[model samples]
Target: MRSGNPRDTDLWEWCCGFYPGSHPGECSGGTAATFDQARADFEAAWRLFLANRTEADFQAWRDHKAWTAEKYRRFDRGERMPHDWRPGQ
Candidate 1:
């Protein structure tokens, strides 16, 4: 059996935003063996990351609102109130 060559493997790193004056705000995963392959990988990774992050943020917001609602319900039911609480003051 023959061993595979390391140079035959396509390894790339993501690179972006290195201009002197203008910030292009553009990014690319650099130097793939083929442009199509690189673009496919980058776009897929970007979309997956975006979706996951957005979902996490939304879930956190929903949990916080639920906790606040529960606290307000307790106050309305006269279960407990803060020491600074006063009626319509």
Candidate 2:
């Protein structure tokens, strides 16, 4: 939530000539996107391909990199579902 928009992190870094700046708004993406939005996304997908998962599932989901791509795509779409994804508390 505090890492700034993962989407826009590089943009702000490029503009500021660095990643993290002194002001919270600079790197926190506080003004960029709602914190609630980011938090919701992260919590929804933190356990994708990990919970009750086997190594084969891990490979199928993450080793080929397609799953990583899918994850970001979901983030971009703000697609959060309770049955679709649920990170541990």
Candidate 3:
């Protein structure tokens, strides 16, 4: 996402902070030079979130959200991440 600062446009800025299931504007974090770097921060935060979760916990999270198991599977298989999932979906 582009930041208000024009210099941040080319940087791989973190879209959200360490909160799992967080979307843009829900949290905050720093930036990086590349996507891999940005994703590393996200993954680290996600791992921390998952550390306290059970299978049921994860299921519960998905139950009311746009993300689904099938979509996650596709993501795990290296498919392009789904973007159609939104509040109404």
Q: Which one is best on TM-score?
A: 3
The TM-score, computed over Cα atoms with residue i paired to residue i, of candidate 2 is 0.23
lDDT of candidate 1 over 13-81, digit per residue (tens): 444322222224433345466657676777775565444444545455566565567669887898874
| Per-residue lDDT over 8-28 for candidate 2, one digit per residue giving the tens place of the 0 to 100 score | 553221121111112333222
Q: Model 3 shows how many backbone clashes? A: 0
Q: Candidate 1: where are CA atoms >4 Å away?
A: 1-53, 81-89
Q: Tell me each candidate's TM-score.
A: 0.30, 0.23, 0.42
Off by over 4 Å in 2: 1-33, 61-89
Model 1, residue 68: distance off in Å is: 0.5
> Across residues 50-80, which tens digit of lDDT does each residue of candidate 3 receive?
5655676545456544455656767889996
Q: What is the overall TM-score of model 1 with all chains considered together? A: 0.30
**lDDT per model, in order?**
0.52, 0.40, 0.59
Q: Who is ahead in TM-score, 2 or 3?
A: 3
lDDT of 1 at 21: 21
As for lDDT, the candidate ahead, 2 or 3, is 3
Q: Output the lDDT of residue 24, model 1.
A: 41
